[model samples]
Target: MPALASDVTVITITRRRPEILLRRCVPATGRQTRPVDHLIVVDDCPGTAERLSAAEGVVWHHASRTPDDMSGPGRSSRLRNWAARQVSTPWIAYLDDDNEWQPRHIETLIEAATAAGADAVHSERNVFHADGRPWLEPIWPWSADDAEGRSLYREMVRLGVAEPGRNVIHDRVDPLDIADGIRMVDTNEWLLRRDVLLELPFTETLTDVHEQGLLGEDDLLLADLVNAGVRISSSRTASVDYYLGGYSNNRLRHQDPDFAWR
Candidate 1:
């Protein structure tokens, strides 16, 4: 049986991508097997909320500043944190504007977390290129199968991180397990408890000097969670589909100068 819809809240953060929001994200979220109590959309684009349809039981909020207007880093983090404050459920799940979730995404995460008594649960994510081509080949520096990735996962296990295969639950995750070379997990693929999440909110400040090559907000948040000793569970099942569009975080084409854009 799926978890109660009243126990979970889904939040989607978007900025000026109404077409993607309406066409892709909305349908996926709406089709979830275990419906959420509240579906909140944090629109970072000013005046875009007025254009969103209200017939889908979606509660919309407009951010004071658009992503382009923000001077420093953490625009996405700030928007997500703001939207999180509006949630009243015990569990919260995030979905990106361009990405999508399988019908059992929430159901799987909630079930796993509940069964393991964990504060957070994460599932695998399948990546796809803009033209609907599979992008499963892990990109360097971020691929979890690399040498650094093996070390990070080993450290996680050494520090009492529960193995999803065994369905075991650990009381707390060790902070020291989070090394500098650790592979970061995507926020869209995880479900977190509301209280624990609020205690270790996403960092809204950018310490990195590079402007164009700014690191991901999800990476920072995951580091914070690890440092805070939050217990996290993982499922190998790919329940989320991440689209690599021009506006994606990795910016595939931009990162690879020689890559062709079709």
Candidate 2:
């Protein structure tokens, strides 16, 4: 295999929404303070790589077949691994088809990593509905007092952040916990150790598994991470906008109180 390229890699696994992924999401990432080495666009759509080539920082990859569960089933993990394996960066960031980071998102993650002395650091997010509705304000707590911050139990009770779908940053640890059953982290916002992720792939069995009708791949991944004794620190400084597309019609048991945070 060729030596992995130098620089941070921002990997995106996309299907159908080429316009949004390439035009909006990719460009926004292009503006990051830490210039991305490559934007790996894993084309989940048939023959979408050619069109995806139009984006500036994109390096397109294709899977042999389409995934059974679009929500999670090995899609993000497979894409991240495939893209990450090519780049020799110490850090790898994941973004989904519909999500976009703020320009400062990467910078913020880098800053938080430097400050906390953490092996992995994850940021919070703002969510939006497809019809331009303000679905949520930033929901995670942001106080130095751990007492004031929402614990995993509180988030689970309210159903805020469980999926491996949020942003995260991680450094090199021998094996990554991508397969545990209970998830307390979101992978979309995660920065991971490129080498570790390359070794332990996401659990296809856990991907898109239904828990009261909600997908639980991300949650399971976190449970695995914590079990591995990896140090994870979370703060609100790094954040992203989770665009709720029309296709994602899964309803939350509660929405109003879930959006309200102290």
Candidate 3:
């Protein structure tokens, strides 16, 4: 019954990391605690569908060229917004190129949001370095009840949650109105309602920056959502393990902020 309660669709935006897609992201969904309606992997790279499809229970959305045949944050963000449109489920969960989800991640988010009477839900991310080192746990911890963690000013001032200046995190709160009644969250660690997400599209302008351009599109998106009256809920149960890699000699595969996502 729990499995049939909601249809969860995972939108994994990827480029030329087929091996990681098959080895990590693919298997992670198979181990999900709830039923996954579909797994859509948007292959922004050319001629990579066969490789991405090697994994079972996977559907591929291969795009020959990005919005401008470009490579960078915009490419991934464009693909993510596209894939979100293809899903028929009521819920959508996003996973990055290098990150993978835990077995109970989706199910936990579903249960938490449903129980908390929230329109959207997000949780902590367990950060892991490329050398397999643990940097921190529960990257951002917030209260369970909306009333407790609802103030945009309070959160921005103390928690340093929405660093709008950095553009890494955006608060949905309106600059003029403090009490918009919407909820905000960490995009990497959340599951969103399908209908609600369709209304909030990622910015294409931010995607066109240089390789190392700093922008908190994700943070800004969440802040805007919360400020718009979307109820945000946080939980410890729903989480993902993010791989943090060091800059190596290999320029082709060096994991830096240039390749790191928003």
Candidate 4:
């Protein structure tokens, strides 16, 4: 049986991107096949939420941040964690302000999770340039095709070439195992059970700090979930269109040699 729309809540954390939220995220979310029970927007920018028109059951929250608040890495994680607490649904789906989901995204993930008995589920995404041209190459780690190293690790464990106790892939293969994986999953592509998320909330700490920029609160949260014996079901069908624009993180990546755009 398919999960009811009332069973899931879609949460979006945005800061000063009202145009993108109104033009892209809002419409796409409204089109979900399994309509969400509620749409929660955690707006960090003051006065931005008021510009958005009201809809029945759409909840808007403005994050209270003091002038002394740390503005770097864990900001999004904190806002998302706060929003998760406001969700009364069984499942929580996340969407960034700049990205748009296909109508079936929530429907697909919910069905997949129900069938697999997974605590979390994620789907592959199609990447596009800001002008809307498709970026043909698979986004590494997010797309299963690029998981060659993970596949190799799993094979090594099965052949006893690598000890199961020492391998990360072994954790995902068995629900009871709680070892961290060698790779990180994309935060935006996942849908998680609300209770599971509450149990292992996103850590409000930075995982990467460089002179160029800071990163990885999302990676830390995913790693924590994987380490807590959460079984994730990933799908290859691309249901989200990730737009690579002049966002702050993308701006930093454009200048960083290690993450230069191909």
Candidate 5:
């Protein structure tokens, strides 16, 4: 292949949300502190690449997905996997269409990866309302009563992520334990080696399997990396603005205090 142009290529997977893709996601990536070398926005819509006409740095690539990819499970992972294959950079970072990164997000991740000599790095994200208001609880503890949340909480505790009566997922993330910790490793918060991700691929999660209402490609990917002994690092600070009303948040819109933090 031709020589890679840059160290990191940010990937934003968008659908028909031209307004958000053009207005929020693209602009946020454009304003990064380190000046992104490449930005590839993968759109499922056929003509969205030409229609978006995004900023200069953005390379809009339309995913001509197969029928199974569209109608079957793991559409998110499938689309992301396809886009990642087209990356021409050494590193690949993800920023979903509904989210925005802090100016130092990419810069911070690169520093962390270099310092730790790691294959992948992750950062923190605080919850914000769709209208730009930060949520009261940046991170919340899993309740001991709810069976599902209880299991998740116990697993986190076993992994040393949280303690009894203490919601401890503030900055640190142990790759081996992050998968069991509920809603911890988000796709938007990761910066991984392009070759590493491609070799492992987004094979786990719902990308190809159909679980009963189980959706966590991020967690599955983390599990795979940990299993493969990938050297993962953490920035340990909130660098991404995780806006509410996205896929995960909207699905749990009816829940209790765990709404935003979960």
Candidate 6:
């Protein structure tokens, strides 16, 4: 049976950062206008799980820790896959431990997906500094000085899709124009169907970061969706605050001189 589009479960994975996860992401879930039906917090650290267990409306689960899952960009996909199995809601959304959604985040994305008859839909995100503001620095994060941020910002600027202060990074991925290279489909900006996620899980993402030293699980997932002809669209509204300089950002590419995601 095709699942109804109304019910939604949010999957958030954290390894050790309880402070931000509790302070930001959990509250963001509770404050959602659509009122999340389920909020799954998968953590590998037992100590972190203990700290987050008391979080209201959050079901904390302890996942088995793998050496590969300890640090890197691709680990998120692995953690998300772990949490996806536990979700019963027909609609599924993603949020990172270090990121936050506006109160209308769920409401906005749901409306867009339903209206477009899309299997998955995404929203724009404002790339903010650690102090909770958009990039206003002369030494911009999106400048050529930063390898990762520059790569992301360059594409978004050419596309003219994002407008956060001076620099723009997160926008929306158009499957039709996906071959053109769009950096807008960050993990937290998307809402997708549970059936679609299960049918095409991001299982092999760890290799992109852990082995190859290239950070690209989200891109691969988007490719999978496009290849499968999943109806994907974008809300074109900036509903997420993707904060930089978080714990994971520092350690995304933990090893190798070749590649680093942050």
Highest lDDT: which candidate?
A: 6
Local distance difference test values of all predictions, in order: 0.64, 0.56, 0.60, 0.64, 0.67, 0.70
User: What TM-score would every model get versus the actual structure?
Assistant: 0.73, 0.68, 0.70, 0.72, 0.75, 0.81
Point to the candidate with the largest TM-score: 6
Residue 177 of model 2, lDDT score: 43
| Model 2: residues with Cα > 4 Å off, grouped in runs | 1-6, 44-47, 66-72, 136-183, 207-215, 246-262
**What's the best-to-worst order under lDDT?**
6, 5, 1, 4, 3, 2
Q: What is the lDDT, from 0 to 100, of the residue 259 in candidate 4?
A: 31
Off by over 4 Å in 1: 1-5, 42-47, 66-73, 136-182, 209-214, 246-262
Q: Which digits, one per residue and each the tens of the lDDT, describe model 6 over residues 26-53? A: 8888888897854555556887878766
Comparing 2 with 6 on lDDT, the higher-scoring candidate is: 6
Judge candidate 1 at residue 248 and give its lDDT: 28
With candidate 2 superimposed using the best TM-score fit, by how many Å does residue 20's alpha carbon deviate from the native? 1.1
lDDT of 3 at 10: 76
Give a tens-digit lDDT track for model 1, residues 112-200. 89888889888876667655566533232233336664564455456544342332223222346455333446778879998987888
The TM-score obtained by model 1 is 0.73
TM-score of 2: 0.68
**Candidate 6 weakest ten by summed lDDT:** 136-145
Q: Please give the distance, in angstroms, between residue 107's alpha carbon in candidate 2 and its true position after superposition.
A: 1.3
| Model 2: lDDT of residue 47 | 50
lDDT of 1 at 197: 76
Query: Across residues 136-173, which tens digit of lDDT does each residue of candidate 2 receive?
Result: 32332222224433453245334433233333222112
> Of the candidates numbered 3 and 6, which has the greater TM-score value?
6
What tens digits encode model 5's per-residue C-alpha lDDT throughout 48-98?
Answer: 676666445456666665543542225667667877787677889988887
Q: What overall lDDT, based on C-alpha atoms, would model 1 receive against the true structure?
A: 0.64
Lowest-sum lDDT 10-residue window in model 2: 253-262
Question: Which is the winner by TM-score between candidate 2 and candidate 4?
Answer: 4
Q: Which segments of candidate 6 are over 4 A away from where they belong?
A: 1-6, 66-69, 137-144, 147-155, 164-170, 175-183, 208-213, 246-262
RMSD of candidates 1 onward, in order: 7.7, 9.3, 8.8, 8.6, 6.2, 4.6
Q: Give the TM-score of candidate 6.
A: 0.81
